[model samples]
Target: METLVFRFEQGQRRIPTAAQLVGVVSSGNLEVLVSRAELQAACEIEVNTAAIGFAPIWQAVMDDFQARWQLADVRIAINDMGATPAVVSLRLDQAIEACLESAP
Candidate 1:
């Protein structure tokens, strides 16, 4: 098992109104938990994976996600079990979408 943490400073500080979670940790799958945070124009992501020796790939995937979203003041936790990068991005997007939909 390997764990990685990343923090990014996004100039846009629009936080979601609520927290959300999506996906499940299983063979070739992962779970994502996202929530509001007091990060002050930043986003923090934590990834725990059963697949080792893929830090570079994970970083690339995360970098792409951050670029695409540009979200701020959010904390995301991903429990990964050998999921592909595509699935990882999908789950992350879904979690954020769910969170936004929860807004009143």
Candidate 2:
């Protein structure tokens, strides 16, 4: 299994209106955990699986998310196991939803 971890921190600036956390498992699986903290917006993702040769793609996806959402304050952690790109993105969106819903 392989692992990828991406972490982001968002300060007090009204983070995303909604956060979601989705898991993708295909002979592998993905798990994401997001929480609020006192710091800049950030994201932490951890991916674990057997699939290889796709680091840049993963990073690109993440980068795209940041660009699309214009996120500057938040944290994201992803755990993947041979999950497809679509699944990865889905999980990320879900994580964001979760974060927003549990925001205090």
Candidate 3:
């Protein structure tokens, strides 16, 4: 078992507006937690195990989301359990929805 840890501080202008949540549990299972903070929405992720040498792929997926959504003031934390890149996006969507529900 191995672990990877990282953190990001998002501004209030990077939060998503009306997001969705979705992911799969085959070869790639994701568990996410999202919340509305003083800035906006925050995210944290944890991955149990991965294919190794795939940081660039992960960064690309995350970057794509940020660019497409124009998220502002959103903090994200992710934990992946040997999940594929697609699963990451799915879990992210799910977490985003959770944020909307919890948003004030």
Q: Return the top candidate by TM-score.
A: 1
Off by over 4 Å in 2: 5-28, 102-104
- Write the candidate numbers in order of decreasing lDDT: 1, 2, 3
Q: List, residue by residue over 32-79, the lDDT tens digit for candidate 1.
A: 989888898899999999899999998998899888888898999999
Off by over 4 Å in 1: none
> Each model's TM-score, in the order given?
0.92, 0.64, 0.58
Q: How accurate locally, in lDDT, is each candidate?
A: 0.85, 0.60, 0.55
Q: What is model 2's C-alpha RMSD?
A: 4.0
Model 3 residue runs over 4 Å out of place are: 1-28, 36-49, 102-104
Give Cα distance to truth, residue 4, candidate 2, Å: 3.5
lDDT of 3 by residue, 7-47 (tens): 34453343444433344344356655444345434333344
- Candidate 3 or 2, higher lDDT: 2
